[model samples]
Target: MTPSVKKIKLGVDVLIENDFDIIENKKILLLTNTTGRTSSGQLTVEEIQRSKKCEIIGLLTPEHGFFTTVPAGQSVNDDIIFGLKTYSLYGNSRKPDSKLLKSCDAVVVDIQDIGIRSYTYISTIFKTMQSCAENGIPVIILDRPNPLGGEIIDGNIVETGKDSFVGIAPISYIHGCTIGELAEMFNNERWLNPKNPDKSKCSLTVIKMVNWKRSMTYEETGLQWWPTSPHIPTVNAVRGAACLGIFGELGIINIGIGTTLPFQYVGAPDFKTEIINDDIKMLKLQGIHFNPTKFQPFYGMYNGKLCDGFFLTFTNDKNFAPYTSGILFFSSLIKYYPNMFDRGKLKQNSIDMFNKVTGSDAVLDALINKKSINDLRKICNKGLDNYRKLRQKYLLYD
Candidate 1:
């Protein structure tokens, strides 16, 4: 479904309409991609260029390059895009070196995030913030509404320093905050520590949205959906990612990675949903139903292969909790087909990565140990109340 308000101005529009007063007359570097645009559909990079706002001396990008030149998980090399030097945070170095930090007076970040912990765009920004804090450079964040909205905080904080690239900040999987709010929390919470030792904070400027509410989903924000990555093409797809992404990292079943559905489809080749239909119902996620279906992927892991899985459908968005539901869904799968999670048959790196993405070994530990759903749920829900209160301090909108 598509919805448009057309009246809401994005941070880019607010930055431009005011004649770039935010960081005018400064040499700045932009960390953005095709997804960065004004409400009027002008590219943020182009708009910055058209105006004498600040000189965009260079560019940096996350997993997907400036124009999505390569697929996900592949390294992106430094190159020129739109006639400017572009650095790849997903390449040799995940953070900007001192040379690039010194080249620009400030760093402007305007990439869109999917609100899921492992999205990686947030990691690139987090890593950049660390470098900027150490180099004494300022970082500007352009706030965007979280696709999944901001009321539903799910998942656990990343363990002390586990798999930080994806789980960089100590927030839940479905962190309920705007990018700006999250940046504020990251700075305030001392997550900028492990790298800087002394925990230096970057000079931050979050140009907030004019009329955004924490309850407003991306569709309610009245903005068009821009593909954040090749996999995440629609806002509905964002929900799918939140529902199955961390579990998808297991890399066993095809969660529609190469298919048109991306994370929306949850089937594997030669598999049938009937095998575990009862287990899925045991998740107890009211209004959340999985309908069995089949598909052939266009590319990626399950390329041209017919996979059997169910698509997630929501009858009640208000009651849905992405990460909590994701865990239950995963738990149900292992409940019936425990062999699917066998580390002996699975890649060790995949299990290691799953633990990393999960911020702890809790999920895998519980699954391997054959713990009950309630047992795993209690373990996962351990620190949620603490997180809810912690997040309240950084929320910018109601």
Candidate 2:
């Protein structure tokens, strides 16, 4: 074994090895998906069930359902898993109803969060925590790696009153914290905002993973990577989603949703990569660079249309800055595709979505007003310093 490599144990392993005392003698409503598996590749549901330390009364799945066959932005349906009642948390309303809560004594969240704010897994857990708070039920979160490493906080905090299913919390776009750690912050920060002030905080127990350091990327943990969603098939895809996700929301450009390399590429039918490629390179996106390429998406925004863009090249994962490279890339795009960012050109709904994902309309305001790329970058990083300070205490790993 390499001396610098540290083998990490997941929270699921810690739960079992610790004898599952947290959920012992309780009826649990487990919130998990296909990604909720151990380092050894065993499903967390099966392991917890096999331990016989707690009675899993029901299963709660987030965006992609039990099998993760569901597509992005689509609602998942409730299904039966192992003869237990399974409820869908990605339906019309994300929170569980009173009847479902009545059936379980506690809520357990074991989903793998990729640490991006726009990703819906965190939102599901956030809403679940709210429900648990109001019902006086405790929530146990099986913590996992942040994937982007817990050291990198990117983008700006979602501004006040900009909360949505995607921007559900006032967190940075790439919040460098685990689901368990975020739960701690959520509870302490009183972001749950339950109907009753007294019930505003949920009792959250975080079963932390062993050997997980803030600076260690998911690959360094020496664990297998499971696609958090259909589009994020690999670690690089996750990075792509962080950097290029905004473009997807605008629908003005194709961000590789339909291709096998979803979120890994960006372009339009008339993007003219040659005109913009050199400028993008000049930005000197740290740890990453790109070369012009083209592809025809089978479906999605640019279905059956060939797009002109570049594929990402990462020289170093540790130094790869998703937010810096992403916002700067968008800034560069605005200069070339000025009309695309025009308020008149963009749909109001799409504009609203972009604002929600970014947590503010500052970027949109800057873009529409013909602001420089540096202006847009400043807007993107507006509250980053304060957010880092705010998130300091909630950090669970070094």
Candidate 3:
């Protein structure tokens, strides 16, 4: 076996080393959580206090709350620490208001991202930037690695009308860029600034990471895996999320929300694994294998019900196309459960949610038109190719 390697130095690490001077004496508001740590595992907030360059007047917590304990979609409350108040960015309001930024001179964002659009952290970043722009505050992003790697850009761009908290920008579902790079894209593209272009654009600075590469996954970096959210319990879960998460939006199947596997398990009470097990096995999906199993979710969709689902295991991290696998799973469900499946049951929320998450109605259109998996993959790949070329200008790492 090869010797275990340590993780690369994070943006916070570099910030403390050299960028501290930029924020010196400024009353700072940190838009981060517990995952913001130094390369040696020290909490970023603690490290910042140690540096003593700027005053951390308060903190802003995102969807999962500061420590990442709150469940998905649940409202969070303020937590007090060291006499400073911690505001809930995920609750009451999703963006910084005058009260939240009171007495603050600048803002610093240092959160770990999984490199997907639907993940709410990036939306929080977008909203934070917008708020800062409106308030004329300079913002700095202590950029972290995009665990999925930056080289693999996939999925369709989110149409402007379909934007939501899950996706505020027009980018691929699995956007392959670091948080810093995404900030740059958001700033330069004027996705948020166009509304108030007359206002002074918020000054954006990105403290880039050291010794990280575009092709390296979190596993390759040898970092301790921390679940970005509650259901995404493992790094392996992140690998499959781009596909599994889309299925969860339909609100019919239980994507292991109440179980240990979350995103790794896909099934419904009426979904008979044996019926399509052979068909799915024949798809020969890249970098993944399937095991038919049954589970009972304690919460979320299909709560307290036995679900006949398949457990997905990724075999090749780099080759797997999650959205294609999702389309395959979706089309397979329609083929086997024509009578039982009901897109109508989802109502408007599910339809809008699906379109927003997948970035368009093309997948649904393909399903409705009875398009073959090969043809669907071809269309999706075309979009991916375009995104890869489009993202070339914003990439920061090699």
Candidate 4:
């Protein structure tokens, strides 16, 4: 099947068109990675280099480094790429230090986000915004679409105590907002304010996407999919990962690092695919199907052992809610095989991580107690109601 071609006017595109007008003759520092590409597959670094009004003084990279050459969880050191001084925001420092931000007049951020609460890119953006605000530097965010679509919000509300790189604030698992919209929320919520510091110090602007709607999925927007991270290789992977990542909290890493479909496949040698299938059938999630299979991962968990499992396939993008779907699957897994699943192996407490991603611990605890979907829905609704009111204040696009 031929993939549909739809032209998306990304936030970077809008920034480029108005570069000469809004930022003429300014020394610009850009925060981007491999996913920050033009509609025609041109890198944002190259585009900024070619712009007449902007001087590309430096490049700032988050988690995966400039070309996404680094492995997950590794720190990136300072390096030279394309003859420019590149700073690693994901390494020793998550935010640009005064030394790095000193050379530029303004900072421009253009990166794609997968919309999951646990993705560190958005947190990186938030920290950068705080740094820029502290140093009295103006920050411009080139907003992109939340590839998972923005109509549906799911999961629990993150609590204050469990904040981490994956989730630094109180938001839903599938936050229905763009990067720009999120920055606005951070600014208004005063989330970046340091202790004993003046609160009125941040300056930020978000260049919103043109012709993008809240209901449009990545496929609907006609934008090409660039793997935001090495593991998230395709839209299907992102959708599946959104659901399967909950397993990580249960100490169930999917297939190894080398596999093409990493998070989509779930199994261990002891896993009973029949049980999983039965639970999934009982739950009756919309827009997805599971196919039973067996495989040996080259690395990571259950390495080099034949493991039985199922691969998730999405039938409709519009009706999918990865976060909620994941919780349901996880609850079922825990219920059916309480002894096999170990929740202690999670980096933070699994309960805490679940609360962080879902936004609250009550729902997960309720699930642990085998709460009905209707009862769970009520718990989720509280967070959604709070998020709706809080989110309304920061929406940049209609």
Clashes of each: 1, 0, 0, 8
Per-residue CA lDDT of model 3 for 316-386, tens digit only, reads 36776776777787788777766323556557787777777776777766776778887787756655666
Compose the digit string of candidate 2's lDDT tens values, residues 1-398.
24687778888889888888888888899999889998889999998898888899889989888887788888988889978778898987799877788778899888888889999999999999998888888898998998888888878888888889899888889889999999998899888984468988988889999988887767678888888788888888888888888767788778888998887778888887997988987887786777699988999888999888888756545657687687778778777777867788788889988888888888778767878777766777888899899899899888
| Best-fitting candidate, scored by lDDT | 2
- C-alpha positional error of residue 337 in candidate 2 after TM-score superposition, expressed in Å: 2.5
TM-score, every prediction: 0.93, 0.95, 0.92, 0.89
| Alpha-carbon deviation at 153 in model 4, angstroms | 1.0
Clashing pairs in 2: none
Rank order by lDDT, top first? 2, 1, 3, 4
What are the RMSD figures for all models against the true structure? 2.2, 1.7, 2.4, 2.9
TM-score of model 3 vs. true structure? 0.92
Error of 1 at 34 (Å): 0.9
lDDT, model 3, position 276: 86
Full-model lDDT for every candidate = 0.81, 0.84, 0.80, 0.76
- Residue pairs in clash, model 1: 267-308
Candidate 1 vs candidate 4: the TM-score winner is 1
